[model samples]
Target: MYTKLKDELLVEAYEHAVRSQLDGEFLQILKEELDRRGIIFDEAKKVATADNNKS
Candidate 1:
């Protein structure tokens, strides 16, 4: 749940950042953070699937 919330916030922040025309460095940071969060979400899903299989 927290991850999902964070993802939503990141999306909003990204859009805002784009609209407001933030510096290149800040935009890159947000993009990298979003990408990292996506990897975390994918790993969580894989773990959940493996746990489900054990049951």
Candidate 2:
């Protein structure tokens, strides 16, 4: 349950960052932080796709 919540929050943060037009070193730092937390963008994409498919 905690893992699921973490993943959801990570996805939300990624979405917010992208929408805010973050780039360069800041974006890289964000990616690195997420990676360190075991949340890669590709995995997030897959999770999002799966969620969409369920609807």
TM-score, every prediction:
0.57, 0.45
lDDT (tens digit, per residue) of candidate 1 on 1-55: 3545455577678769999999989999988976765523343333122334469
- lDDT for model 2: 0.63
**Cα lDDT, all candidates:** 0.65, 0.63
The ten-residue window of minimal lDDT in model 1 covers 39-48
Q: What's model 1's TM-score?
A: 0.57
Clashing pairs in 1: none
Name the top TM-score candidate: 1
Candidate 2 lDDT at 5 equals: 44
lDDT, candidate 1, equals: 0.65
Q: Please write out the lDDT profile of model 2 over residues 1-55, one tens digit for every residue.
A: 3544466676677778888988767767767766665654464365343334558
- TM-score of predicted model 2? 0.45
Among these predictions, the greatest lDDT belongs to 1
